[model samples]
Target: MRHTWRWFGPVDRVSVQDAAQAGALGIVSALHHIPTGDVWPVEEIAKRQAEIAAGGLHWDVVESIPVSESIKTQTGAWREHVANWQETLRRLSAVGIKTVCYNFMPVLDWTRTDLRWTARHGAKAMRFDRIDFVAFDIHLLERPAAPADYDPETRDRALQRFRAMSDERKLSLSRNVGAGLPGSADGYSLPQLRAHLETYAGIDRDRLKRHLFDFLSEVTPVAEEVGINICAHPDDPPWALLGLPRVLSTADDYADMLAAVDRPANGMTFCTGSLGALAANDLPAMVRQFGPRIHFVHLRNVRREEDRTPCSFYEDEHLEGDTDMVAVIAGLVAEEKRRKTEGRPDHQIPMRPDHGQEILDDLTRGAQPGYPAIGRLKGLAELRGIERALSHLTYGLS
Candidate 1:
């Protein structure tokens, strides 16, 4: 595996130097300054590359080129957005950055109810409190159909939870749930969120999935021609949210996606944290099954509050979460060996320590919500130790 760190560019509190110091040889990043649906000029790409290079780290993978909402819904300007996305891939390939990661989650990206939920060990980790999310959905957002999405007991629980909150807590919950991730392009106010939901009124799971397949059909050929691998990130939490459809939540979803586009360039970003949130996803089995098609990896873990779908989960310590980190890493290592034996050039997968708990000086550093420097450094160290031990024991490497 090629160890990397995610850097949110110049404005990010966690600098590229910090990533290098954390022992990452490659940087996974994106041109977040570029607006969605715009072509990424080679000049901007070169500049960011130069910036990372100056810190002694090469930009190895793009965390994303945001998939525009227009494209996801196949609505206004969607055709133009697809063309622009192809152009961006071409530009990235021209600059020797061939692996690109993007997600098709509508309206909002990965979300959490609490950005600073305290852990038992006195560290701060991000959490998605299930009842809190339900309360926000039904009581705060007041989506008319929100009640129908939950059971009667759950709706009652959410209502009670909402009633117990103070005004300040209510407002905080609304902000945390509505606002997208720090660098995402899809933050929304309540009215805006409602309007967005209205737009998806008739587009259920099947229709949304067809749109994704259509998108892959349009871009995968361009990707193959340009020698770029476009990997779709699995839906965070791996389920529907805010009444919107989620097609890429399960292993079968990925299998369908790959089959629909049946191209080498069409692939998946194996995000353990996102997929692991759903207890049903067997992390190691999925890795072994999709190894050939997985182009990037986010090796984080989450502890599900319940043993079912739509339950709350907190980002847990990488090795301590429900997912067996050792087994997953071993599968990935085995996949890399298989690729090597098959003479594939992309044998070594690029992986980063996804969302670490805030600990040590990280508590004061105030880095991006889930991207504390020292915490991720610790995660990377632990992951590296696991990979080394697995290699030595399973493959006889010293």
Candidate 2:
């Protein structure tokens, strides 16, 4: 794996020099200054690439050029937005950036009810608690038909939890869920968020999937022409939220997506934590099945919901969660070798340790999700050690 860090432009708390110290040789970043639906100028892309290279790292992948909701729904301005995205890809490829990662999760990118969940080890981990989400959807944001979204038992428990919350607790829960999580644009107020959710109300799962296909069908050919691979990220948690549908959450979703576009330029970013959230998604099997199309990766693990809550989980140690980390990495290594032997471009699959827990050094720092230095440094070290051992065992170190 070509270890990389997600840099949110110059304003990011973590600097390129800081990333260098973290032992990452690649920077997974974007021209975030250009808002969604705007074409990323080639000059701007060159400037960012120069900035990353100045720190002795290569701009390996564009973490995203966010897809606009209009494009996702094939509604107002969608054709224009799709054209802009194609232009962005063409510009990015001109600057030597080949891999671009984007997700189709409606409204929020990745939802976490608790920004800070205390672990048994006493470290802080980002979490998604179901009751908090339910309280937000039902009592706070007050989405229509939220009651029917949950089963009887869940609805009762959510009501009980909502009744017990003080005004402040209720407000905070609303903000936490409605406000976008880390790497998202920004959190929205109740009224603003509801308005956003309303946009997706008419765009159900099937419609969203069709929109995604249409967007891909338009962009993939441009990607192929420019030598850029567009990789779609899976839906975080692989479930519906606030009655808004999620389409890119499963293996079948990926199959349908690629088939729609039917181009190698259309690809995937195999985020283990996102897909692994679904208990049925076999991470290793997915790697084998989609290996050829996977151009980038995000490696992280999560403990599933406890019996106490329907959608509760905390970031687990790299080797500790539901995902079979070893087998997943091994499959990637096999693909790497196969690509090399076939005289392919040897796509340096850049990976970042997503959502690391706050550990000893940064316990009180209120570090952002998955961006703390200490925890992710440990994760990268562990993954690298495993990769080295596997490389020796599998290919005898050449």
Candidate 3:
């Protein structure tokens, strides 16, 4: 596998040089300054490429070209947005960047309720407490249909938790849940969020899935023609959030998605932390099953606070979480060997240490939440060690 690091461009506190020092050969990044529905001009892509090249690294993957809400709902200039997305793919291919990772999560991207939960060793990690999220949904956002989404027991627990929070805590919780992450476009105010949610009034899971398929139908051909792989990132938390439907959460979801387009250009971004959040997913098994369709990988792990659905989880060390990191890497190694034997062009996959704990000087640096430098360096070293051992055992270190 090719080691990559995610860099959020010039505005990011963690510079591209930091990624190089961390031992990453490739960078996973995006033109985040570009608005959601606009086309990424060739000039902009070239400029960003030049920036990464100046750091002695090449941009291996585009973390995302944000799928606009209009595209997700198939309303309000969605057709034009699809045209813009196709153009972006063509331009990216023209620049020799083939892998494009994107997500179809509506209204918000990857979410967390607590950004600085202290771990056992006093390192700060990102966490998603179900109760806290529920409190935010019901008591803070006060969505009309929110109560019906939870059972009586959960509803009561959330209400009690909300009532116990101080005013400052409540404000903090709202900001954490409502705001977008680093690469996302912009955060939403309460009324703005509510207005956006109203747009999906009757679009249930089945309808949303159809929209995704429709999108693939239109763009996958362009991707195939241009030699680009468009991979959909699995939904973070791997579940429904804020009354929205999450179609890409399970192994079956990936199976269905790949089957929808049935093309090499339409693929999956295998994210262990996101898929592993749901206890039901068998990580290694999914890797083996979808090996051929996996275009990009995000290597991270999460510790589920409980064994139930909708339970809380926090980002854990790269190798210390519930996921069997060794077994997962073993599967990836085996896949690479098979690809090599078959003489496939895309034999070595591109992967990155997904998110890391805030340790050492990370706490004071105010680096992007979940993207501290030293912490990710630690993760990359550990993951690289595992991959090396697996390769040695599998191929006898030729």
Residue-level lDDT tens digits of model 2 in 248-361 = 888999999988888888999999988888887888999999988998999888998664324677788887888889899988888888778877784557788776878987
Candidate 3, 62-170: lDDT as tens digits: 9898888999999999999999999999999998998999998888788899988999789999999999899999988999999999999999999999999999989
lDDT of 2 at 44: 85
lDDT of 2: 0.81
Q: What lDDT does the true structure give each of the candidates?
A: 0.91, 0.81, 0.92
TM-scores for the candidates? 0.97, 0.95, 0.98
Shift of residue 354 alpha carbon in model 1, Å: 0.4
TM-score for candidate 2, residues paired by index: 0.95
Q: TM-score rank, highest first?
A: 3, 1, 2
Candidate 1 residue-wise lDDT, 34-141, digit = tens = 888888888999999999999899999998988888888889999999999999989899889979999999887888999989997899999999999999999889
Q: Which residue runs of candidate 2 sit more than 4 Å off their true CA positions?
A: 307-310, 393-398
Report the Cα lDDT for residue 322, model 2. 81
C-alpha lDDT (0 to 100) for residue 219 of candidate 3: 93
- Where does candidate 3 have its weakest 10-residue lDDT segment? 389-398
Worst 10 residues of 1 by lDDT: 389-398
